[model samples]
Structure formats: structure tokens, C-alpha cells
Target: MSWLVTGGAGYIGSHVVRAFIEQGITPIVVDDLSSGHREFVPDGVDFVEGQVQDTSLLERTMREHDVEGVMHIAGYKYAGVSVARPLHTYSQNVQGTAAVLEAMQRVGVSRIVFSSSAAVYGTPDVDLVTEDQPTAPESPYGQSKLIGEWLLADQARALELTDGATPLQHVSLRYFNVVGSGTDEVYDTSPHNLFPLVIEALIEGRTPRINGTDYPTPDGTCVRDYVHVADLATSHVAAATAMAEGRELRPVYNLGSGDGLSVREIMDAMQRGTGHTFEPVIGERRPGDPARIVANGDAAARDLDWRMRHSIDDMVTSAWQARTAHPDISE
Candidate 1:
């Protein structure tokens, strides 16, 4: 029995793939390679080059690999850019999720773990975001992820209504800012993520810029919860194992650090970790950026063995080492 990981060629998905292997579970990867690197997929793993939106491809892959569950991580994940590309975001996230669900139903696979986002709680009023927090997404990307969660719920409900049908055992993991690296083999390569952006600037002998320094925070910049990618990947494995063992789980869990770090503080850490001492260029706040958004991971810790295994320095140093190790892939 194997689990199919959508977008397993990408940064986060690739780490999850390795985590599954370490736990003695087989993983089949399906990726379109739009933003993922083929080399990121380890050797000997079954990989299908295709979009998750293609139901036939997903169904065929599931049957071919004897897939018992799915870790759906493929989506247009840029929240800020989604403001200008709502249709693209919805098509990739919402429609893609629908296709995955359809394929699962066709193959009689009843388990899924969706990669959701904290953007679902747009500028949450509460200081510490919880699973019970009301969702008010600000960007199209956030809305699309929220809709993806809805699709899972709706599909499970429909299955429940069917007689003699196995109920869907599913969970959605809402991630905040996922940083750091699980292994030098696979690191965060996204041009949009903060860690890579800053690392790229340092490597190119350029000063990184911090957008919006006048926010209502101690550092006057947007504060966000950051979690190590390796720690995050472990939780995915935990969730999958829990479902396979018939353990009950909440519909949603936030894989977040209970605290936050401002963009300026991140810059400081970057300088110390990368040995590039330069003041960041202050820029105007990008539209739709929340001042601060941290989350409580108590539920995930209890159910999914979640915890902050790495410090900010660990996140920075590991990311730097991994990125610098792959000069050919660095942009």
C-alpha cells in the first residue's frame, strides 16, 4: 500500500516524501513540475508527470500504485499574487481539489490530508489563532484554500449519505510560514517565500527589502508564525499514520508556532546566519498584508505530534546551507 503525494517534486512536498520514506511508508509522486524540480524527487520513487486537475491521470496513478491515501499539496500558493490572478488561483486550488476528490472516489480511496493555509483567517482578531477561529480569507488564494477544505467536508458528507460506503477519514493541515530544510537534498526553492528571497539577495550581493515597516507591531513590520519544514513534514506523516490506524482526528489543525517574528527580526537573523550584514531596504506595505498572525498548535501537538523542533537560527542556518549547497539550482 502506498500514499500518493501531489506536487511531491516541490519543496515542501518533497520533504514530506522523504519523511514518508523514513517512516517505512511508500510514496508515489504526481507533479506537473510547473514550480517543482524533477531532480527534487528521489530516485526509485514512482513519479507521474501530470497536473492534479486531471482526474483520469490521478485515478490511473492511484490504481497503478495501490494508493491507500493522498497528501494533496499541489496548488497555486502565492497569496499576494492571487489578488491579481483570482481565476488562476481558484482553478488550481479549488478545481484541483475537486478533481483529487473525484479521483479518490472513483478508486474507492477514503483518506486524504489537505495542505491548507493560515491565510484563511484574514487578519484574525484573536492574537492566538485556533482551529475554532472564524475564517475570513482576504485574498483569492486564501478563499481557494478555504474552498478546498469545504470540498473535503462536502465529499465526506456525500459519502456518509451513501449506504455501505466507507466514510472518508480526512484532515486539513493549515500551515503558517513554512521555512528551513529537512535535508540538503530538498530545500525551500520558492522565489516567493521569505527565506529564499532573503537568501537569494544575500548570495547575489544585494540588500533584501522589507515591505511595510509601519505596521501596528513592535517592529513596525508584519509579524508571522514560522515553522520548520521538517517539523511540518513529520506532522503529515503522523496524520497519515493516525488515519491508517483508525484514530479519530479533527477536521482541521493548525501546524503553527504559537509565537511570531517580525520581518525586521527575520532580517536580523538572516544577517547573523548568512554573515551578510546589510540594512534591509524599507518599502511600502504590499496590499492585503496583515500586521500580525500567529497560531496555537496545541491541537496539532496533541493529535499529530507537532512541536517546534528548530529555533529561528536553525531555520536560517539550515536554509542557508541547503540553498548554498545547490548553486546550480539557485536563482
Candidate 2:
């Protein structure tokens, strides 16, 4: 049986599919090509071009592929943009997740690994945000993710109430500033992300700028966790493996580096990796900017084999390599 990965044609989803292959498992891809590339699905993999919101299509794909589990990563994932498009965010993330759960229930697929986000924590007060902290999402995208988590928890509870029904085992992975390219074939293409923005500026002969250099940090810049995409993909596969093995797993896991790097440090790495030397222009801090927000990944480390395997330099290097490989990306 194969694991169906929703949004399998997207950047992170593509990496997850590759990781499953590395673990000697089959992957079935389902994507609508909305913000996902068709070329990223890899040859020899079964792909169904459709949205997760279409429950009938999802059910059909699951049944046809003999799907044993699902990696639900399809969603409208831009947090800043979601502020302007709240309805669209809820429709894609909230409604889309509900449809996936319903399809799983119909097909008796008992395992799911959700792609959650650290945005659910908003501007956290603590330096090292833990899973136990209360969720106070400041944007619609974050609220949608938190609500998706609630939907899974509620479904699992409801399934337990059904007599003689196999319990729905699921885990939601909260991602924090996912960066780096695991493979040259797949790299982040989001317009609003940091790495892409910085790389695009340098390629276009413009200086990459940092926002708010007066933050309460050693570098006078905001500090945030940046995990390598390859490492994140491996943990996602591990969660699926544990579920397939009938091993009890936690409800949620945060993929993060316990200590994070600053924006200035990231700029330095970009310069070193891309061989570009220019002083970054300082700009006003965006509203709701947090001085620092790293997460404690010890729980995920103990359970999901999560670790900071790649350094900041490694992240910048791999990302630059991928960016250069695709000559037209900056254009």
C-alpha cells in the first residue's frame, strides 16, 4: 500500500515524497497545480491532479492507490498574505483539511500526518517556545492550522466513541521557518519567504535588506529558527512510519532548532554562500514582528529522530545552489 501525499507537487511536499522513497515506501501524489509544479512529482510515482477539497476525488485516489495513510500538506500557506485573504485561507486550509479527514473516514485510512505551522503561536513571549504554550494565532492562516489540529483531535475522539472502530492515529508537525533545498530538483518558490526574497534581490543586482535592526538581540535583529528542509522531510516520513507500525505517537511535534540564528547572521551566510558582498539596507520592522521565537525540539528529537543536521551555512549554500540551477527563477 502507498501513502497518499496531498500537495505532493509543492516544494516541501515534493521533499516529503522523496523521503518516503528513501525509506523504501510507495507514494501517491495528489495536487491541483495551484502553487505547485507538475515537474516536481518525479517520474514513476502515481499522481492525481486534483484539489484536496474535492472529497470524491480524494476518496477515489485513496481507494485506487490502496492508500494506508495520508500526509496532508496541501493548504494556502502564506501567513502575511492570509491577513488580506482570510476567507481564502479558511477555505483552503480549514475546509480543505475537513474534506481530507472526511475522505479518510470513508476509505478507512487510519493514519494521517498533518503539516501544521509555528504561526499558531503568533508573537510568543518566551525565547524558546514549547508545544505546551497556548496557541494565540494572530493571522487567519495560523488560525486555520490550529483549527485543523482541532479537527483532527476531534475526529480521533469521535472515532474512539465508535464501538469496534480502529482509532484514527494522527500527528501534526509544526514547522518553524523551513529553509534550504534538500535536492537541486526541488527548492522553495514562495514569493514572500526570506531565502527566496534575499536570493532574488542579489540576482537582480539589488541589496537585500533587513527590517528593524533595533530589536532586543545581540545582533540588533530579529532571531528565528530555520530548519533544513531535508531534515524536516525525514521527520515527516518517520511520523508516517510510526503510524504504519501501530506505534503510539504524540499528537503534535515541532520541527525547529533549539537555538536560532539572527537575520544578520543569515545575511552573512547568504553573502558567503552566494559570493555576494553588499551591506544590507535596514528598514522599518513590520508590525507584529517578534524579537525572537525559537522552539524546543527535544520532544520531536526523542520521538521523530529530528535534529539540526544542517548549519546556517549549509542552508544558504544548498538554497543558493538550487537557485543558481534554476536560472529563470529570479526573473
Best by lDDT: 1
Candidate 2 accuracy as TM-score: 0.96
Per-residue lDDT for 180 in model 2?
A: 92
Could you give me the TM-score of model 1 versus the true structure? 0.99
Cα lDDT tens digits for candidate 2, 1-331: 5899999999899999999999998999999999899888889999999988999999999999899999999999888788889999999999999999999999999999999998889878888888998898888988999999999999999999999776899999997688999889988888877898899899899999898999889999989899999999999999999887877888998887999799999999999999999899999876545677788998899989999999999999999898789997546
lDDT of 1: 0.93
| Residue 179 C-alpha lDDT in model 2 | 91
Candidate 2 local accuracy as lDDT? 0.91
Clashes of 2: 0
Give the clashing pairs for model 1.
none
Off-target runs (Cα >4 Å) in candidate 2 are 287-289, 329-331
TM-scores vs. true structure, each candidate? 0.99, 0.96
